[model samples]
Target: MLKNVAVALVDGVTPFEFGIFCEVFGIDRGDQGLPVYDFAVCAAEEGPLTMADVGFTITPPFGLERLEEADLICLPADRRAPVRDDYPEPFLDVLRRAVDRGARVLSVCSGAFVLGAAGLLDGRRCTTHWLHAPALIRRYPAALVDPDVLYVDEGPVITAAGTASGIDACLHVVRQAHGAEVANTIARRMVVPPHRDGGQAQYIQRPLPRTACDTVGEVIGWTARHLDEEITVEQLAERAHMSPRTFARRFLQETGTTPYQWVLRQRVLLAQELLESTDDTVDAIAGRSGFGNAAALRHHFLRTLGTTPNAFRRAFRGPRAVA
Candidate 1:
């Protein structure tokens, strides 16, 4: 029954993240058999609103009234200037009322700050851009800031980390409300991966050189090709021609996660593929994905994905799937 999605934009909002919300939920993609969203751009105030470095202003059709009818309301990131004690009380009131009415609320990047200021995020698990997470936590200790994951879906509220992950979270919402098929079609249209494992740290300002010579692309490619084998941090370090400590530092800088964590995600991804596409048994899939056994695979999958392999496969490929 969910249809109308209202996005609340404020001054100095990050254009790309705001645009992603519109693209994912606002577009009328009914031609592809996708459900259409009754999308509207609403502002906390009336009149012209300036975007960052865009040299133009956008006039939103609805004001705070948009929140009253919104099935889902999105708060896009804004600059740090708006968080002072005197900031935007009327907007906060609207958000509080919308949430009270059981409308789903979402925030991308530092828009988490706005929700936090409104007290909507208190005692809730949330995430934001890693660069702003620590400060956000310090400013509002009541919020459970998790700077690690791409997004967290806690019942009626969802918060996505950083900018691009906003797309990932929005796609996830599509996947949840509709299904994976619809989400995948949208992702294909956008030319982005349907999912990116781990969190925003994995995509931050990587310390590795952008050029091939100074990067970990080759080594990572090699690791992916050999996930069935026992791989260790030391072995990966040797492959990169660096000591374990240095490699660990650089790996986190490049991938925003430890080598082991990266391997785990890839291994799970391989397991998921096997579950969906092959008639492999759970034991066989686990062995091929480097989980050693079915039990091990089940543990990690349930821990990270919140579902057992069997249930996930059944939901994706159908009940007849061997998982």
Candidate 2:
């Protein structure tokens, strides 16, 4: 039902989140029979806009006028930085008009700040980069900010956490409007996994560990490859040639979480992928994902994913297991 999609660009737009909007809506896949969106890369400003980094200049085809014609409006990360007080008033005005006219709106990552600035996110379930979550909540007490989730679809306004989560949010919109078959096809064409487990916090780049300089990184890579193995901090410390206390602190510094928590999160991610793409039973998936048993898998799954494995599989693959 969506025919027109417009992405609003301004000074300081993040290239990656902006790309998510373009890739999802701008591409014409008529030969492949995908539903088409009349995508327009428009600008609040009349001329060329500068990005955060040098060497990238975006020239928008339409002006603020495009906002009225848009069925869906995507606000990618803006340069105004999440904690800033002031932004271009004209840009905020355009966003306000689009929402007042019934266009579905989406904001990826810190773009939620833009929406918040426009007053569109008041009393809405929204998310932003986890690092900015506390600030957003503190600044705008009306917004319900959930930092632990991948994306939140609150009626006509959807907000995604971080940059790459924008991809998942867009694919989710396609899936809801079209179906999983079409969404999966688009994802395959893009050479990206159709869905990601957990939120962006899991992928947020952390400063590397200082103490376990020799082997911590290697251990992380190894743990990823051998997720099915029973691993412990002592074992990992031995591998890193550091004492347990030092390894734990350094690991937390490097990954932004305790080592055990990191491993559990990664295992959950692995299980999520298997659930989406394979016909493995819950018990089998539990074993393969290093959860040891179905009960343990269910405990972590509910705590982290907010759904049971069976429920997630059902949502992704329908009534029966994929064969």
Clash numbers, per candidate: 0, 0
Model 2 RMSD to the real structure? 8.6
The deviation in Å at residue 275 for candidate 2 is 19
| Per-model lDDT | 0.82, 0.83
Q: Model 1, 31-118: lDDT tens per residue? A: 8889998899998765688887778888898898878899899988887533544447898988888888888888998888888888
Local accuracy of candidate 2 as per-residue lDDT tens digits, 266-311: 8888887888888888899999999999999999987887777877
Tally clashes: model 2: 0
C-alpha RMSD values across all candidates: 9.6, 8.6
Candidate 1 vs. true structure, TM-score:
0.64
Candidate 1 achieves a global lDDT of: 0.82
TM-score per candidate, chains pooled: 0.64, 0.66
**RMSD, candidate 1, Å:** 9.6
Clashes of 1: 0
